[model samples]
Target: MNLNLRHAVISNVSGNNQGQLQDTIVDAIQSGEEKMLPGLGVLFEVIWQNADDQDKQEMLATLEQGLKK
Candidate 1:
Protein backbone atom coordinates (compact mmCIF):
# COMPACT_ATOMS: atom_id res chain seq x y z
CA MET A 1 0.00 0.00 0.00
CA ASN A 2 1.02 3.59 -0.55
CA LEU A 3 2.25 5.62 2.40
CA ASN A 4 -0.80 7.86 2.33
CA LEU A 5 -3.17 4.93 2.41
CA ARG A 6 -1.26 3.31 5.22
CA HIS A 7 -1.27 6.54 7.18
CA ALA A 8 -5.01 6.93 6.67
CA VAL A 9 -5.68 3.43 7.95
CA ILE A 10 -3.46 4.03 10.95
CA SER A 11 -5.38 7.21 11.70
CA ASN A 12 -8.65 5.35 11.44
CA VAL A 13 -7.47 2.61 13.78
CA SER A 14 -6.23 5.16 16.29
CA GLY A 15 -9.52 7.01 16.26
CA ASN A 16 -11.61 3.85 16.53
CA ASN A 17 -13.18 2.76 19.80
CA GLN A 18 -10.45 1.22 21.97
CA GLY A 19 -11.87 -2.25 22.57
CA GLN A 20 -13.04 -2.52 19.00
CA LEU A 21 -9.59 -1.70 17.65
CA GLN A 22 -7.93 -4.37 19.80
CA ASP A 23 -10.58 -6.93 18.88
CA THR A 24 -10.28 -6.16 15.19
CA ILE A 25 -6.49 -6.51 15.23
CA VAL A 26 -6.52 -9.71 17.28
CA ASP A 27 -9.24 -11.23 15.13
CA ALA A 28 -7.34 -10.30 11.99
CA ILE A 29 -4.19 -12.02 13.27
CA GLN A 30 -6.01 -15.07 14.53
CA SER A 31 -7.78 -15.48 11.19
CA GLY A 32 -4.54 -15.03 9.23
CA GLU A 33 -5.85 -12.05 7.30
CA GLU A 34 -2.74 -10.99 5.42
CA LYS A 35 -4.08 -7.58 4.44
CA MET A 36 -5.13 -6.80 7.99
CA LEU A 37 -1.67 -7.52 9.37
CA PRO A 38 -0.25 -4.52 7.58
CA GLY A 39 -2.90 -2.34 9.12
CA LEU A 40 -1.96 -3.65 12.55
CA GLY A 41 1.71 -3.06 11.87
CA VAL A 42 0.92 0.48 10.78
CA LEU A 43 -0.98 1.03 13.99
CA PHE A 44 2.01 -0.16 16.00
CA GLU A 45 4.33 1.99 13.94
CA VAL A 46 2.13 5.00 14.51
CA ILE A 47 2.12 4.37 18.23
CA TRP A 48 5.87 3.94 18.31
CA GLN A 49 6.38 7.01 16.18
CA ASN A 50 4.26 9.22 18.38
CA ALA A 51 5.25 7.89 21.75
CA ASP A 52 7.61 9.72 24.10
CA ASP A 53 11.10 8.23 24.25
CA GLN A 54 10.55 6.48 27.56
CA ASP A 55 7.21 5.12 26.50
CA LYS A 56 8.67 4.00 23.21
CA GLN A 57 11.39 2.13 25.05
CA GLU A 58 8.82 0.45 27.25
CA MET A 59 6.67 -0.43 24.29
CA LEU A 60 9.60 -1.86 22.38
CA ALA A 61 10.61 -3.92 25.37
CA THR A 62 7.08 -5.25 25.69
CA LEU A 63 6.93 -5.99 21.99
CA GLU A 64 10.22 -7.88 22.16
CA GLN A 65 9.02 -9.95 25.07
CA GLY A 66 5.76 -10.70 23.33
CA LEU A 67 7.66 -11.88 20.27
CA LYS A 68 9.54 -14.41 22.39
CA LYS A 69 6.30 -16.12 23.30
Candidate 2:
Protein backbone atom coordinates (compact mmCIF):
# COMPACT_ATOMS: atom_id res chain seq x y z
CA MET A 1 0.00 0.00 0.00
CA ASN A 2 1.10 3.49 -0.73
CA LEU A 3 0.20 6.74 1.02
CA ASN A 4 0.41 10.27 -0.28
CA LEU A 5 0.89 12.41 2.79
CA ARG A 6 0.74 15.78 1.11
CA HIS A 7 -2.39 15.00 -0.85
CA ALA A 8 -3.98 13.47 2.20
CA VAL A 9 -3.16 16.53 4.27
CA ILE A 10 -4.55 18.85 1.62
CA SER A 11 -7.69 16.78 1.24
CA ASN A 12 -8.22 16.82 4.97
CA VAL A 13 -8.04 20.58 5.07
CA SER A 14 -9.59 21.29 1.71
CA GLY A 15 -12.92 22.30 3.08
CA ASN A 16 -11.48 24.83 5.46
CA ASN A 17 -11.74 28.55 4.77
CA GLN A 18 -9.16 31.17 5.70
CA GLY A 19 -10.26 31.64 9.30
CA GLN A 20 -10.65 27.94 9.94
CA LEU A 21 -7.28 27.25 8.37
CA GLN A 22 -5.71 29.86 10.59
CA ASP A 23 -7.37 28.32 13.62
CA THR A 24 -6.20 24.87 12.64
CA ILE A 25 -2.65 26.03 12.17
CA VAL A 26 -2.65 28.04 15.36
CA ASP A 27 -4.19 25.22 17.33
CA ALA A 28 -1.73 22.66 15.99
CA ILE A 29 1.24 24.92 16.74
CA GLN A 30 0.19 26.11 20.17
CA SER A 31 -0.63 22.60 21.32
CA GLY A 32 2.99 21.58 20.71
CA GLU A 33 2.18 17.93 20.25
CA GLU A 34 4.29 15.52 18.24
CA LYS A 35 1.33 14.33 16.18
CA MET A 36 0.74 17.83 14.86
CA LEU A 37 4.25 18.08 13.44
CA PRO A 38 3.43 16.27 10.20
CA GLY A 39 0.54 18.60 9.47
CA LEU A 40 2.74 21.61 10.11
CA GLY A 41 5.41 20.11 7.87
CA VAL A 42 2.87 19.65 5.07
CA LEU A 43 1.73 23.23 5.52
CA PHE A 44 5.32 24.44 5.34
CA GLU A 45 5.88 22.36 2.23
CA VAL A 46 2.97 24.09 0.50
CA ILE A 47 4.27 27.50 1.50
CA TRP A 48 7.80 26.71 0.38
CA GLN A 49 6.65 25.36 -2.98
CA ASN A 50 4.71 28.53 -3.80
CA ALA A 51 7.28 30.99 -2.45
CA ASP A 52 9.36 33.16 -4.79
CA ASP A 53 13.12 33.64 -4.43
CA GLN A 54 12.77 36.76 -2.32
CA ASP A 55 10.08 35.15 -0.18
CA LYS A 56 12.23 32.09 0.27
CA GLN A 57 15.23 34.20 1.25
CA GLU A 58 13.13 36.16 3.71
CA MET A 59 11.79 32.96 5.18
CA LEU A 60 15.29 31.56 5.56
CA ALA A 61 16.47 34.77 7.15
CA THR A 62 13.52 34.77 9.52
CA LEU A 63 14.23 31.19 10.41
CA GLU A 64 17.88 32.00 10.99
CA GLN A 65 16.97 34.91 13.22
CA GLY A 66 14.51 32.83 15.18
CA LEU A 67 17.02 30.07 15.58
CA LYS A 68 19.63 32.51 16.76
CA LYS A 69 17.25 33.81 19.40
Candidate 3:
Protein backbone atom coordinates (compact mmCIF):
# COMPACT_ATOMS: atom_id res chain seq x y z
CA MET A 1 0.00 0.00 0.00
CA ASN A 2 1.21 3.43 -0.90
CA LEU A 3 0.79 6.02 1.82
CA ASN A 4 1.62 9.70 1.88
CA LEU A 5 1.31 10.63 5.53
CA ARG A 6 2.21 14.31 5.13
CA HIS A 7 -0.43 14.80 2.49
CA ALA A 8 -2.93 12.85 4.56
CA VAL A 9 -2.25 14.85 7.70
CA ILE A 10 -2.54 18.22 5.93
CA SER A 11 -5.74 17.14 4.20
CA ASN A 12 -7.20 16.04 7.52
CA VAL A 13 -6.70 19.52 8.90
CA SER A 14 -7.56 21.46 5.79
CA GLY A 15 -10.09 24.28 6.10
CA ASN A 16 -9.74 24.30 9.87
CA ASN A 17 -10.11 27.70 11.47
CA GLN A 18 -7.36 29.15 13.61
CA GLY A 19 -9.08 28.07 16.80
CA GLN A 20 -9.64 24.57 15.49
CA LEU A 21 -6.03 24.30 14.38
CA GLN A 22 -4.88 25.57 17.75
CA ASP A 23 -7.08 23.03 19.47
CA THR A 24 -5.65 20.21 17.37
CA ILE A 25 -2.11 21.24 18.18
CA VAL A 26 -2.85 21.73 21.87
CA ASP A 27 -4.66 18.43 22.15
CA ALA A 28 -1.86 16.57 20.42
CA ILE A 29 0.76 18.12 22.69
CA GLN A 30 -1.26 17.63 25.83
CA SER A 31 -1.97 14.00 25.01
CA GLY A 32 1.77 13.22 24.86
CA GLU A 33 1.18 10.17 22.71
CA GLU A 34 3.97 8.87 20.50
CA LYS A 35 1.60 8.40 17.61
CA MET A 36 0.83 12.10 17.64
CA LEU A 37 4.48 12.94 16.98
CA PRO A 38 4.20 12.10 13.31
CA GLY A 39 1.16 14.30 12.94
CA LEU A 40 2.99 17.16 14.62
CA GLY A 41 5.99 16.61 12.41
CA VAL A 42 3.87 16.68 9.29
CA LEU A 43 2.27 19.88 10.46
CA PHE A 44 5.68 21.39 11.10
CA GLU A 45 6.85 20.39 7.66
CA VAL A 46 3.89 22.18 6.13
CA ILE A 47 4.61 25.22 8.23
CA TRP A 48 8.29 25.16 7.38
CA GLN A 49 7.70 24.92 3.67
CA ASN A 50 5.32 27.85 3.62
CA ALA A 51 6.90 30.08 6.23
CA ASP A 52 8.67 33.24 5.12
CA ASP A 53 12.26 33.89 6.08
CA GLN A 54 11.24 35.92 9.13
CA ASP A 55 8.83 33.29 10.27
CA LYS A 56 11.40 30.58 9.70
CA GLN A 57 13.89 32.52 11.73
CA GLU A 58 11.36 32.95 14.50
CA MET A 59 10.62 29.26 14.49
CA LEU A 60 14.32 28.49 14.62
CA ALA A 61 14.74 30.91 17.50
CA THR A 62 11.86 29.28 19.33
CA LEU A 63 13.34 25.87 18.68
CA GLU A 64 16.71 27.00 19.97
CA GLN A 65 15.09 28.45 23.07
CA GLY A 66 13.22 25.22 23.62
CA LEU A 67 16.38 23.19 23.32
CA LYS A 68 18.24 25.45 25.72
CA LYS A 69 16.13 24.50 28.66
- How much lDDT does each candidate structure score? 0.80, 0.89, 0.91
TM-score of each: 0.71, 0.86, 0.90
- Candidate 1 residues 5-68, lDDT tens each? 7877866766678898889778888989677777777877778788999998898799899999
**Highest TM-score against the true fold, candidate:** 3
lDDT of 3 at 28: 100
Task: Write the residue-wise lDDT of candidate 2 on 1-69 in tens digits.
Answer: 124877888898988899999998999999999988888889888889999999999999999999998
Clashing residue pairs, candidate 2?
none
Model 2 clashes, total count: 0
TM-score of structure candidate 2: 0.86
* Stretches of candidate 1 exceeding 4 Å from the true structure: 11-14
Residue 35 in model 2: shift from native, Å?
Answer: 0.6
Superposition-based RMSD of candidate 3 using all C-alpha atoms, in angstroms: 2.1
Better of 2 and 3 by TM-score: 3
Estimate the lDDT of model 3.
Answer: 0.91
